[model samples]
Target: MRKNSIKNTRINGEVQKELSTIIRNEIKDPRIHPMTSVMAVEVAPDLKTCRAYISVLGEKEAKEATIKGLNSAEGYIRRQLARNLNLRNTPEIRFILDESIEYGVNMSKLIDDVTKKDSNSHRQDEEQDEN
Candidate 1:
């Protein structure tokens, strides 16, 4: 099967959904923050390995701790995935920190600030013209 085949995509989506549920409801590790979320999942064509991208809305330390907690619970998570998905090979899971959401929010804030400044300048120019 090709790496980007529909089968792989379906597997990836299923894994992501199951992982989100497992992490949110099953895992009770204290190190994981309440705001942690599974952002995306990518599974290899062979289904031997899977990468889960996680996003945590918290400080850097919290994010690091969450990743550590998830890594420590990797075995349990894989087992749960196997039980839930009934796959022949429960892919070895790897947790990766995803910062794209945070980056996007920051970029939006910056754009808003620039837009506000430009509008204020335009208003001031209009006022001067009226004088």
Candidate 2:
């Protein structure tokens, strides 16, 4: 059961794919990190605005630079998108930093640390009990 309309979903997928390609191959701004990716795209129902979630695999400064670069190139991106896709009006692109991947990685590391500590404590408890 999907909440979005079929048209919206299709548009979202197309926009995501096209944007990823554009960012990776077309945009040549040095400020844009090579490790940047279009994680997701959300287009408004009216198809006038689009929010692109970008994930950059780098330091804070690199991420900020990448976002700034992308924002500056929004018009170019929109033109490219319009050329590639036959949409009547290309949505106004907005770049947003997506940190879910980094958050997940940090959370995983924390869980692993806790698990290791628990195992070590259990081992010590077993040794004390045998003594």
Candidate 3:
């Protein structure tokens, strides 16, 4: 299957859904953070390999532990995937830590702070002009 094809997209979505479900409900690993989520999934065109982007809402240690937990359970996760979906080949799963969501949140906060300060400065300038 060609990359970005309809079939590939569908497969990626399916994998992402299943991965989230498995991690959220099935896995009992203590190292896996409860706030962990599957951010995205990219399955190769041949379906031989997959990259799972995972987001954890916590500190650096939590993110690292979550990834470690997921990596340790790769075999079980793959088996679960095969049972849940009828694919020609179950892709080898690789867990990647994704910080985009957290980064975006931080960036938003920074922007808001800047805008607030800018407005406050404008108010001060107006008061000085009036004086």
The per-model lDDT (C-alpha) reads: 0.96, 0.94, 0.98
2 or 3, which is superior by TM-score?
3
How many clashes does the backbone of model 1 have? 0
lDDT of 2 by residue, 1-131 (tens): 13398988999999999999999999999999999989889998877999999999999999999999999999999999999999877999999999999999999999999999999999999999999
- Residues 31-109, candidate 1, lDDT per residue (tens digit)? 9999999999999888899999999999999999999999999999999999999787999999999999999999999
Residue range 1-131, candidate 3, lDDT tens digits = 89999999999999999999999999999999999999999999999999999999999999999999999999999999999999999999999999999999999999999999999999999999999
TM-score for all models, in order of appearance: 0.98, 0.96, 0.99
How does residue 41 of candidate 2 score in lDDT? Answer: 95
Residue pair clashes in candidate 2? none
For model 1, the stretches where C-alpha displacement exceeds 4 angstroms are none
TM-score of 3: 0.99
Candidate 1's displacement at residue 30, Å, is 0.5
Per model, state how many residue pairs clash.
0, 0, 0
Which candidate wins on lDDT? Answer: 3
Give the 10-residue window scoring lowest on summed lDDT in candidate 1: 1-10
Task: Give candidate 2 misplaced runs (Cα > 4 Å).
Answer: 1-3
